[model samples]
Target: MGWLSDSPQLLILKDCLARRLLSCHVYPELRNLPESAQGEELELADFSAFLAQEVWPTLPPSFREASFETRSALPDDLDSVPLDSTPVSFVDTLVSYGITADAEGAQTLLRKVLAEYVSDACAAPPVWSSTRARECEICEREIPLTYHHLIPRATHAKALKKKWHPASMLNAVAWLCRPCHTVVHQIATNEELARSYHSVDLLLEREDIQRWGKYASKQRFGVRRG
Candidate 1:
Protein backbone atom coordinates (compact mmCIF):
# COMPACT_ATOMS: atom_id res chain seq x y z
CA MET A 1 0.00 0.00 0.00
CA GLY A 2 2.82 2.40 0.91
CA TRP A 3 4.54 1.63 -2.37
CA LEU A 4 1.45 2.83 -4.19
CA SER A 5 1.70 6.24 -2.57
CA ASP A 6 2.62 8.95 -5.07
CA SER A 7 3.13 6.29 -7.70
CA PRO A 8 1.80 7.49 -11.04
CA GLN A 9 1.65 3.90 -12.25
CA LEU A 10 -0.64 2.86 -9.41
CA LEU A 11 -2.78 5.94 -10.00
CA ILE A 12 -3.34 4.84 -13.58
CA LEU A 13 -4.35 1.37 -12.41
CA LYS A 14 -6.87 2.82 -9.97
CA ASP A 15 -8.22 5.05 -12.71
CA CYS A 16 -8.62 2.00 -14.93
CA LEU A 17 -10.43 0.25 -12.10
CA ALA A 18 -12.71 3.25 -11.55
CA ARG A 19 -13.53 3.43 -15.26
CA ARG A 20 -14.22 -0.29 -15.34
CA LEU A 21 -16.42 -0.13 -12.28
CA LEU A 22 -18.32 2.81 -13.66
CA SER A 23 -18.78 0.91 -16.94
CA CYS A 24 -17.16 3.78 -18.78
CA HIS A 25 -16.30 1.52 -21.73
CA VAL A 26 -12.80 0.14 -21.34
CA TYR A 27 -10.54 -1.95 -23.55
CA PRO A 28 -11.73 -5.57 -23.59
CA GLU A 29 -8.40 -6.79 -22.23
CA LEU A 30 -8.68 -4.56 -19.15
CA ARG A 31 -12.26 -5.65 -18.58
CA ASN A 32 -11.12 -9.26 -18.48
CA LEU A 33 -9.10 -8.81 -15.29
CA PRO A 34 -10.85 -10.29 -12.28
CA GLU A 35 -12.64 -7.76 -10.10
CA SER A 36 -10.42 -8.75 -7.21
CA ALA A 37 -7.36 -7.93 -9.26
CA GLN A 38 -8.21 -4.27 -8.75
CA GLY A 39 -5.86 -2.76 -6.10
CA GLU A 40 -3.76 -5.88 -6.16
CA GLU A 41 -0.21 -6.41 -7.39
CA LEU A 42 0.11 -7.04 -11.10
CA GLU A 43 2.95 -8.03 -13.41
CA LEU A 44 3.62 -5.58 -16.25
CA ALA A 45 2.77 -8.30 -18.75
CA ASP A 46 -0.48 -9.07 -16.96
CA PHE A 47 -1.36 -5.40 -16.86
CA SER A 48 -0.43 -5.10 -20.51
CA ALA A 49 -2.61 -8.05 -21.37
CA PHE A 50 -5.56 -6.52 -19.55
CA LEU A 51 -5.10 -3.23 -21.38
CA ALA A 52 -4.81 -4.99 -24.70
CA GLN A 53 -8.00 -6.89 -24.06
CA GLU A 54 -10.05 -4.07 -22.58
CA VAL A 55 -8.74 -0.61 -23.52
CA TRP A 56 -7.17 -1.45 -26.87
CA PRO A 57 -10.43 -2.78 -28.25
CA THR A 58 -12.14 0.56 -27.90
CA LEU A 59 -9.36 2.62 -29.47
CA PRO A 60 -8.90 3.25 -33.18
CA PRO A 61 -6.76 0.66 -35.01
CA SER A 62 -4.11 3.29 -35.67
CA PHE A 63 -3.87 4.08 -31.95
CA ARG A 64 -3.75 0.42 -31.10
CA GLU A 65 -0.76 -0.24 -33.36
CA ALA A 66 0.95 3.12 -32.86
CA SER A 67 4.65 2.74 -32.08
CA PHE A 68 5.63 4.29 -28.75
CA GLU A 69 9.22 4.74 -29.93
CA THR A 70 8.18 6.95 -32.83
CA ARG A 71 5.72 8.83 -30.64
CA SER A 72 8.24 9.59 -27.87
CA ALA A 73 11.07 10.70 -30.13
CA LEU A 74 10.46 14.42 -29.50
CA PRO A 75 12.79 16.57 -27.38
CA ASP A 76 12.48 16.16 -23.61
CA ASP A 77 11.04 19.64 -23.19
CA LEU A 78 7.60 19.35 -24.78
CA ASP A 79 6.91 23.08 -24.21
CA SER A 80 9.40 23.97 -26.92
CA VAL A 81 7.09 22.39 -29.55
CA PRO A 82 4.19 24.16 -31.25
CA LEU A 83 0.70 23.71 -29.76
CA ASP A 84 -0.51 21.60 -32.70
CA SER A 85 2.58 19.40 -32.74
CA THR A 86 3.80 17.95 -29.46
CA PRO A 87 5.26 14.46 -29.29
CA VAL A 88 3.54 11.92 -27.07
CA SER A 89 5.36 10.52 -24.07
CA PHE A 90 6.22 6.83 -23.67
CA VAL A 91 5.49 7.31 -19.98
CA ASP A 92 1.87 7.83 -20.96
CA THR A 93 1.70 4.28 -22.34
CA LEU A 94 3.09 2.87 -19.10
CA VAL A 95 0.73 5.03 -17.03
CA SER A 96 -2.25 3.78 -19.01
CA TYR A 97 -1.36 0.21 -18.10
CA GLY A 98 -1.89 0.72 -14.32
CA ILE A 99 1.46 -0.71 -13.28
CA THR A 100 2.02 2.08 -10.77
CA ALA A 101 3.14 1.80 -7.11
CA ASP A 102 0.06 2.23 -4.87
CA ALA A 103 -3.36 3.64 -4.03
CA GLU A 104 -2.20 7.22 -3.46
CA GLY A 105 -0.60 7.20 -6.85
CA ALA A 106 -3.88 5.93 -8.20
CA GLN A 107 -5.62 9.03 -6.82
CA THR A 108 -3.34 11.27 -8.84
CA LEU A 109 -4.18 9.38 -11.99
CA LEU A 110 -7.87 9.55 -11.16
CA ARG A 111 -7.66 13.34 -10.84
CA LYS A 112 -6.09 13.56 -14.28
CA VAL A 113 -8.71 11.27 -15.76
CA LEU A 114 -11.51 13.22 -14.11
CA ALA A 115 -10.01 16.46 -15.34
CA GLU A 116 -10.07 15.14 -18.89
CA TYR A 117 -13.61 13.97 -18.40
CA VAL A 118 -14.61 17.41 -17.23
CA SER A 119 -12.88 19.07 -20.16
CA ASP A 120 -14.55 16.76 -22.64
CA ALA A 121 -17.93 17.07 -20.99
CA CYS A 122 -17.74 20.85 -20.97
CA ALA A 123 -16.72 21.06 -24.63
CA ALA A 124 -20.29 21.83 -25.63
CA PRO A 125 -20.96 25.52 -26.27
CA PRO A 126 -21.70 27.44 -23.11
CA VAL A 127 -25.26 28.58 -22.44
CA TRP A 128 -25.67 31.85 -24.30
CA SER A 129 -26.92 34.73 -22.14
CA SER A 130 -29.61 35.68 -24.67
CA THR A 131 -30.83 32.09 -24.97
CA ARG A 132 -30.73 31.70 -21.19
CA ALA A 133 -32.79 34.86 -20.77
CA ARG A 134 -35.48 33.43 -23.06
CA GLU A 135 -35.67 30.10 -21.24
CA CYS A 136 -34.98 31.19 -17.66
CA GLU A 137 -36.95 29.22 -15.04
CA ILE A 138 -36.96 31.47 -12.00
CA CYS A 139 -39.94 33.78 -11.52
CA GLU A 140 -40.61 37.00 -9.45
CA ARG A 141 -37.27 38.23 -10.71
CA GLU A 142 -35.02 37.97 -13.71
CA ILE A 143 -33.23 34.63 -13.72
CA PRO A 144 -30.42 34.64 -11.21
CA LEU A 145 -27.08 35.82 -12.44
CA THR A 146 -25.88 32.50 -11.14
CA TYR A 147 -27.72 29.32 -10.16
CA HIS A 148 -27.49 28.03 -6.64
CA HIS A 149 -28.62 24.61 -5.54
CA LEU A 150 -31.23 24.82 -2.74
CA ILE A 151 -29.59 22.12 -0.71
CA PRO A 152 -26.21 23.48 0.23
CA ARG A 153 -23.65 21.07 -1.14
CA ALA A 154 -21.68 21.15 2.12
CA THR A 155 -24.48 19.03 3.67
CA HIS A 156 -24.13 16.35 1.02
CA ALA A 157 -22.03 13.26 1.52
CA LYS A 158 -18.62 13.57 -0.09
CA ALA A 159 -18.86 10.63 -2.48
CA LEU A 160 -22.08 11.57 -4.30
CA LYS A 161 -21.21 15.24 -4.85
CA LYS A 162 -19.55 15.18 -8.22
CA LYS A 163 -19.18 18.35 -10.29
CA TRP A 164 -20.41 16.58 -13.44
CA HIS A 165 -23.34 14.69 -11.96
CA PRO A 166 -26.76 16.12 -12.78
CA ALA A 167 -28.43 17.98 -9.93
CA SER A 168 -31.11 15.95 -8.11
CA MET A 169 -33.04 15.78 -4.81
CA LEU A 170 -30.00 14.81 -2.81
CA ASN A 171 -28.42 17.61 -4.77
CA ALA A 172 -31.29 20.06 -5.04
CA VAL A 173 -30.18 23.53 -6.07
CA ALA A 174 -31.91 26.79 -6.81
CA TRP A 175 -31.26 29.71 -9.05
CA LEU A 176 -31.84 32.93 -7.16
CA CYS A 177 -30.85 36.53 -7.66
CA ARG A 178 -28.38 37.83 -5.09
CA PRO A 179 -30.97 39.74 -3.07
CA CYS A 180 -33.59 36.98 -3.16
CA HIS A 181 -31.00 34.43 -2.17
CA THR A 182 -29.96 36.43 0.88
CA VAL A 183 -33.56 37.20 1.85
CA VAL A 184 -34.60 33.59 1.38
CA HIS A 185 -32.02 32.48 3.90
CA GLN A 186 -32.58 35.36 6.30
CA ILE A 187 -36.32 34.67 6.35
CA ALA A 188 -35.98 31.07 7.47
CA THR A 189 -33.82 28.53 9.16
CA ASN A 190 -32.04 25.90 7.13
CA GLU A 191 -34.41 23.11 8.14
CA GLU A 192 -37.51 25.17 7.42
CA LEU A 193 -36.09 26.28 4.11
CA ALA A 194 -35.26 22.75 3.18
CA ARG A 195 -38.81 21.63 3.97
CA SER A 196 -40.41 24.52 2.09
CA TYR A 197 -38.33 23.64 -0.94
CA HIS A 198 -40.53 20.59 -1.53
CA SER A 199 -42.57 22.67 -3.99
CA VAL A 200 -42.29 25.94 -5.79
CA ASP A 201 -45.95 26.71 -4.94
CA LEU A 202 -45.29 26.26 -1.24
CA LEU A 203 -42.32 28.60 -1.40
CA LEU A 204 -44.07 31.26 -3.44
CA GLU A 205 -47.32 31.05 -1.47
CA ARG A 206 -45.50 32.58 1.49
CA GLU A 207 -46.16 29.49 3.60
CA ASP A 208 -42.86 30.22 5.26
CA ILE A 209 -44.13 33.71 6.02
CA GLN A 210 -47.27 32.32 7.65
CA ARG A 211 -45.32 29.77 9.65
CA TRP A 212 -42.88 32.38 10.86
CA GLY A 213 -45.63 34.88 11.58
CA LYS A 214 -47.44 32.37 13.76
CA TYR A 215 -44.28 31.53 15.62
CA ALA A 216 -43.35 35.18 16.11
CA SER A 217 -46.83 36.27 17.23
CA LYS A 218 -47.01 33.40 19.67
CA GLN A 219 -43.67 34.40 21.13
CA ARG A 220 -43.99 38.20 21.21
CA PHE A 221 -47.62 39.33 20.80
CA GLY A 222 -49.32 36.34 22.50
CA VAL A 223 -52.07 36.73 19.87
CA ARG A 224 -52.61 33.31 18.32
CA ARG A 225 -55.52 33.67 15.88
CA GLY A 226 -56.60 30.08 16.32
Candidate 2:
Protein backbone atom coordinates (compact mmCIF):
# COMPACT_ATOMS: atom_id res chain seq x y z
CA MET A 1 0.00 0.00 0.00
CA GLY A 2 2.81 2.42 0.87
CA TRP A 3 4.46 1.58 -2.49
CA LEU A 4 1.52 3.08 -4.35
CA SER A 5 2.08 6.48 -2.77
CA ASP A 6 5.78 6.31 -3.59
CA SER A 7 5.10 5.16 -7.18
CA PRO A 8 3.62 8.43 -8.41
CA GLN A 9 6.32 10.48 -6.73
CA LEU A 10 9.00 8.21 -8.21
CA LEU A 11 7.46 8.49 -11.63
CA ILE A 12 7.43 12.28 -11.43
CA LEU A 13 11.05 12.36 -10.41
CA LYS A 14 12.01 10.01 -13.22
CA ASP A 15 10.17 12.15 -15.77
CA CYS A 16 11.93 15.28 -14.56
CA LEU A 17 15.29 13.53 -14.76
CA ALA A 18 14.55 12.28 -18.25
CA ARG A 19 13.76 15.76 -19.49
CA ARG A 20 16.89 17.09 -17.83
CA LEU A 21 18.96 14.35 -19.44
CA LEU A 22 17.45 15.09 -22.83
CA SER A 23 18.56 18.66 -22.39
CA CYS A 24 22.15 17.63 -21.64
CA HIS A 25 24.96 18.60 -23.98
CA VAL A 26 26.64 15.21 -23.64
CA TYR A 27 23.61 12.99 -23.79
CA PRO A 28 23.80 12.27 -27.49
CA GLU A 29 27.34 10.94 -27.37
CA LEU A 30 26.41 8.68 -24.50
CA ARG A 31 23.35 7.56 -26.40
CA ASN A 32 25.47 6.61 -29.36
CA LEU A 33 27.80 4.51 -27.22
CA PRO A 34 27.60 0.75 -27.58
CA GLU A 35 26.19 -1.37 -24.79
CA SER A 36 29.48 -3.26 -24.63
CA ALA A 37 31.54 -0.17 -23.72
CA GLN A 38 33.54 -0.62 -20.50
CA GLY A 39 33.19 1.74 -17.49
CA GLU A 40 36.51 3.64 -17.38
CA GLU A 41 36.94 3.39 -21.13
CA LEU A 42 33.64 5.08 -21.76
CA GLU A 43 34.14 7.66 -19.04
CA LEU A 44 37.51 8.64 -20.57
CA ALA A 45 35.96 9.04 -23.98
CA ASP A 46 33.33 11.38 -22.50
CA PHE A 47 35.90 14.14 -22.06
CA SER A 48 37.81 13.51 -25.27
CA ALA A 49 38.25 16.61 -27.40
CA PHE A 50 38.26 14.34 -30.44
CA LEU A 51 34.55 13.57 -30.37
CA ALA A 52 33.35 16.76 -28.64
CA GLN A 53 33.26 19.24 -31.47
CA GLU A 54 32.61 16.55 -34.05
CA VAL A 55 29.56 15.35 -32.21
CA TRP A 56 28.06 18.72 -31.35
CA PRO A 57 25.36 18.37 -33.97
CA THR A 58 23.98 15.22 -32.42
CA LEU A 59 23.85 16.56 -28.90
CA PRO A 60 20.47 17.18 -27.37
CA PRO A 61 19.15 20.72 -27.32
CA SER A 62 20.62 22.71 -24.45
CA PHE A 63 18.82 24.97 -21.98
CA ARG A 64 19.46 27.80 -24.41
CA GLU A 65 17.25 26.07 -26.94
CA ALA A 66 14.36 25.99 -24.50
CA SER A 67 14.95 29.63 -23.61
CA PHE A 68 14.79 30.62 -27.27
CA GLU A 69 11.23 29.39 -27.69
CA THR A 70 10.04 31.77 -24.99
CA ARG A 71 11.62 34.91 -26.36
CA SER A 72 10.59 34.54 -30.02
CA ALA A 73 6.87 34.27 -29.30
CA LEU A 74 5.68 37.86 -29.53
CA PRO A 75 6.45 39.57 -32.82
CA ASP A 76 5.83 43.16 -33.84
CA ASP A 77 2.31 42.44 -35.07
CA LEU A 78 1.27 41.44 -31.58
CA ASP A 79 1.78 45.02 -30.44
CA SER A 80 5.01 43.82 -28.90
CA VAL A 81 8.29 45.58 -29.51
CA PRO A 82 10.84 43.45 -31.32
CA LEU A 83 13.21 42.92 -28.46
CA ASP A 84 16.91 42.30 -28.98
CA SER A 85 16.06 38.94 -27.44
CA THR A 86 13.93 37.87 -30.41
CA PRO A 87 16.59 36.95 -32.96
CA VAL A 88 19.03 35.59 -30.41
CA SER A 89 16.36 33.30 -29.05
CA PHE A 90 15.42 32.24 -32.58
CA VAL A 91 18.90 31.10 -33.59
CA ASP A 92 19.25 29.21 -30.35
CA THR A 93 16.10 27.27 -31.14
CA LEU A 94 17.08 26.73 -34.76
CA VAL A 95 20.52 25.40 -33.92
CA SER A 96 19.08 23.00 -31.39
CA TYR A 97 16.69 21.37 -33.83
CA GLY A 98 17.74 22.51 -37.29
CA ILE A 99 19.74 19.78 -39.00
CA THR A 100 22.42 22.12 -40.32
CA ALA A 101 21.74 25.59 -38.95
CA ASP A 102 20.08 26.18 -42.30
CA ALA A 103 16.56 25.40 -41.10
CA GLU A 104 14.37 26.56 -38.24
CA GLY A 105 13.57 24.48 -35.15
CA ALA A 106 10.01 23.30 -34.51
CA GLN A 107 7.18 24.95 -36.40
CA THR A 108 6.55 27.34 -33.52
CA LEU A 109 10.14 28.57 -33.63
CA LEU A 110 9.93 29.00 -37.39
CA ARG A 111 6.70 30.91 -37.08
CA LYS A 112 8.03 33.37 -34.49
CA VAL A 113 11.17 34.09 -36.47
CA LEU A 114 9.11 34.58 -39.62
CA ALA A 115 6.66 36.85 -37.85
CA GLU A 116 9.35 39.09 -36.39
CA TYR A 117 11.09 39.24 -39.76
CA VAL A 118 7.89 40.00 -41.64
CA SER A 119 7.08 42.79 -39.24
CA ASP A 120 10.53 44.26 -39.74
CA ALA A 121 9.88 44.29 -43.49
CA CYS A 122 8.17 47.62 -43.13
CA ALA A 123 11.33 48.97 -41.50
CA ALA A 124 9.95 50.74 -38.46
CA PRO A 125 6.49 50.71 -39.88
CA PRO A 126 4.25 53.78 -39.94
CA VAL A 127 7.40 55.42 -41.26
CA TRP A 128 7.71 54.20 -44.82
CA SER A 129 9.60 56.61 -47.07
CA SER A 130 10.73 56.66 -50.67
CA THR A 131 13.30 53.99 -51.50
CA ARG A 132 15.48 56.58 -53.18
CA ALA A 133 15.00 59.05 -50.37
CA ARG A 134 16.07 56.66 -47.62
CA GLU A 135 19.60 55.47 -46.94
CA CYS A 136 20.64 51.86 -47.37
CA GLU A 137 19.77 50.03 -44.16
CA ILE A 138 22.98 48.03 -44.12
CA CYS A 139 25.68 50.41 -45.34
CA GLU A 140 23.78 53.51 -44.35
CA ARG A 141 24.81 54.80 -47.75
CA GLU A 142 22.57 57.06 -49.73
CA ILE A 143 22.93 55.11 -52.93
CA PRO A 144 20.65 53.16 -55.22
CA LEU A 145 18.63 51.06 -52.83
CA THR A 146 16.64 47.91 -53.44
CA TYR A 147 14.42 45.70 -51.38
CA HIS A 148 15.79 42.35 -50.26
CA HIS A 149 13.36 39.68 -49.26
CA LEU A 150 14.72 38.11 -46.09
CA ILE A 151 13.09 34.75 -46.69
CA PRO A 152 14.25 34.53 -50.32
CA ARG A 153 10.75 34.34 -51.81
CA ALA A 154 11.25 30.64 -52.56
CA THR A 155 10.77 29.83 -48.88
CA HIS A 156 7.72 32.04 -48.42
CA ALA A 157 5.44 29.06 -48.14
CA LYS A 158 7.55 27.57 -45.37
CA ALA A 159 7.89 30.94 -43.65
CA LEU A 160 4.35 32.25 -43.73
CA LYS A 161 3.15 33.26 -40.28
CA LYS A 162 -0.55 32.43 -39.97
CA LYS A 163 -0.60 34.21 -36.60
CA TRP A 164 0.60 37.58 -37.85
CA HIS A 165 -0.67 39.85 -40.62
CA PRO A 166 -1.71 38.58 -44.06
CA ALA A 167 0.73 36.75 -46.33
CA SER A 168 0.68 39.48 -48.98
CA MET A 169 1.85 42.00 -46.39
CA LEU A 170 4.26 39.59 -44.67
CA ASN A 171 6.99 40.10 -47.19
CA ALA A 172 9.79 40.19 -44.56
CA VAL A 173 11.77 42.65 -46.62
CA ALA A 174 14.82 44.78 -45.88
CA TRP A 175 16.56 47.67 -47.64
CA LEU A 176 20.06 47.36 -48.99
CA CYS A 177 22.18 48.97 -51.66
CA ARG A 178 23.61 46.88 -54.49
CA PRO A 179 26.90 46.05 -52.79
CA CYS A 180 25.33 45.39 -49.41
CA HIS A 181 22.68 43.28 -51.01
CA THR A 182 25.30 41.35 -52.89
CA VAL A 183 27.33 40.78 -49.74
CA VAL A 184 24.30 39.52 -47.81
CA HIS A 185 23.31 36.99 -50.45
CA GLN A 186 26.92 35.90 -50.65
CA ILE A 187 27.17 35.03 -46.96
CA ALA A 188 23.68 34.09 -45.82
CA THR A 189 21.13 31.47 -46.83
CA ASN A 190 17.40 32.12 -46.84
CA GLU A 191 17.14 30.68 -43.34
CA GLU A 192 19.89 32.92 -42.01
CA LEU A 193 18.32 35.93 -43.63
CA ALA A 194 14.82 35.15 -42.42
CA ARG A 195 15.86 34.13 -38.91
CA SER A 196 18.53 36.70 -38.15
CA TYR A 197 19.17 39.49 -40.63
CA HIS A 198 15.68 40.83 -40.97
CA SER A 199 16.57 44.24 -39.54
CA VAL A 200 19.14 46.93 -40.36
CA ASP A 201 20.44 46.88 -36.82
CA LEU A 202 20.90 43.10 -36.92
CA LEU A 203 22.81 43.31 -40.19
CA LEU A 204 25.00 46.13 -38.88
CA GLU A 205 26.02 44.08 -35.87
CA ARG A 206 27.87 41.42 -37.83
CA GLU A 207 31.65 41.73 -38.15
CA ASP A 208 31.52 40.32 -41.67
CA ILE A 209 28.88 42.88 -42.53
CA GLN A 210 31.02 45.67 -41.09
CA ARG A 211 33.88 44.72 -43.38
CA TRP A 212 31.53 44.60 -46.33
CA GLY A 213 30.04 47.94 -45.44
CA LYS A 214 33.50 49.50 -45.38
CA TYR A 215 34.46 47.93 -48.67
CA ALA A 216 31.13 48.57 -50.39
CA SER A 217 30.77 52.16 -49.26
CA LYS A 218 34.42 53.14 -49.71
CA GLN A 219 33.73 55.84 -52.25
CA ARG A 220 30.00 56.18 -51.85
CA PHE A 221 29.23 58.82 -49.27
CA GLY A 222 25.83 58.21 -47.69
CA VAL A 223 22.88 60.40 -48.54
CA ARG A 224 21.07 61.49 -45.42
CA ARG A 225 17.51 60.23 -45.29
CA GLY A 226 14.70 62.73 -45.70
Give the number of the best model, judged by TM-score.
2
Cα lDDT tens digits, model 2, 113-176, are: 3343333332232323333337777767787778887556766665544212224323656778
Q: For model 1, what is the C-alpha lDDT against the true structure?
A: 0.39
TM-score of 2: 0.38
Per-model TM-score versus the true fold = 0.26, 0.38
Report the C-alpha lDDT of model 1 over 26-116, residue by residue, as the tens digit: 3343444555454433433345334333432343332222222223333344323222211123234434544333444433443444334
Segments in model 1 whose C-alpha atoms lie over 4 Å from true places: 1-139, 158-167, 207-226
List CA RMSD, all candidates.
Answer: 16.1, 17.8
Task: Write down the lDDT of every candidate, Cα atoms only.
Answer: 0.39, 0.47
Q: In candidate 1, where is summed lDDT lowest over 10 consecutive residues? A: 81-90
